[model samples]
Target: MARTPSAMKYHRQSEKRRLDNRARKSTIRTFTKKALAAADSGDVDAAAKYQKVVQGLVDRAAKGSTLHKNTAARRKARLAKRINAAKASQGSA
Candidate 1:
């Protein structure tokens, strides 16, 4: 199939957006991992900080359509659950 000028332009735009979205998602994953590790290691302060950052990123991603709103909500909820559980254990320990 021959590439039309508009189709070629759209392909380039989509490629750039895909890369941007990938980077955003990667950052979210990295921060979420770090946050979970901190929580598990009983570093509550660090975990809280990381969670805050993750929440902000997730919210932005959702708003920008990089992620679905419900998916973002679920991710945030799960992270909060784990972080809170860690805190609870810390208290009992």
Candidate 2:
């Protein structure tokens, strides 16, 4: 489909980048789920640790342009809120 050499090279690069981005996105989702699970279990320490990992993943995704910075911030905020709520509930109980 690519007529020029540069176009062919770009097509190949695009395919590789797509695969890499998909992997990174899946990894980010996995970390997010881990954090949420920890929060659900009411494990404050584990939730905090997983939240840190999620934050790192979000930051990397935003930095790499795979995810928008605002979107990443929003996700981090939501996850942090959940973790904090779990911590508070555990403290009270």
Candidate 3:
């Protein structure tokens, strides 16, 4: 559909960027899920490890513009809250 040479090049570049962004987004989801599962399992050490990974993923996603900064922040906050709650509940038990 891109008749112009420049337009074709731009299309190719955009597709590549889209693929890269998709990969980053997927990675973020996976990291968040791992962190959540660790928290749910009430394993403090594993939760901590996954939390760090999730934080890094969120930062990378925000930096790359694959995710909005505020969205990333919100997700990170929720994940931390869950981890903390799990930790507290385990301590009480």
Top-scoring candidate (lDDT): 1
Candidate 3: TM-score? 0.94
Candidate 3 lDDT tens digits, 1-93:
898999999999999999999988888789778888888887888988988988998898898778899999999999899999999999999
Q: Would you list the C-alpha lDDT of every candidate in the order shown?
A: 0.97, 0.91, 0.89
Query: Measured by TM-score, how close is model 2 to the native structure?
Result: 0.94
The parts of candidate 3 lying over 4 Å away from their true place are: none
From the highest TM-score down, the ranking of the candidates is 1, 2, 3
lDDT of 2 by residue, 1-93 (tens): 999999999999999989988999999899889889989987789889988998998899899878999999999999999999998899899
Show where candidate 2 strays beyond 4 Å: none
Error of 1 at 36 (Å): 0.2
lDDT of 1: 0.97
The candidate with the higher TM-score, 1 or 3, is 1
Q: Assess candidate 2 and give its lDDT.
A: 0.91
Candidate 3 residue pairs that clash: none
Arrange candidates by lDDT, descending: 1, 2, 3
My TM-score estimates for the predictions, one after another, are 0.97, 0.94, 0.94
**Candidate 1 segments exceeding 4 Å error:** none
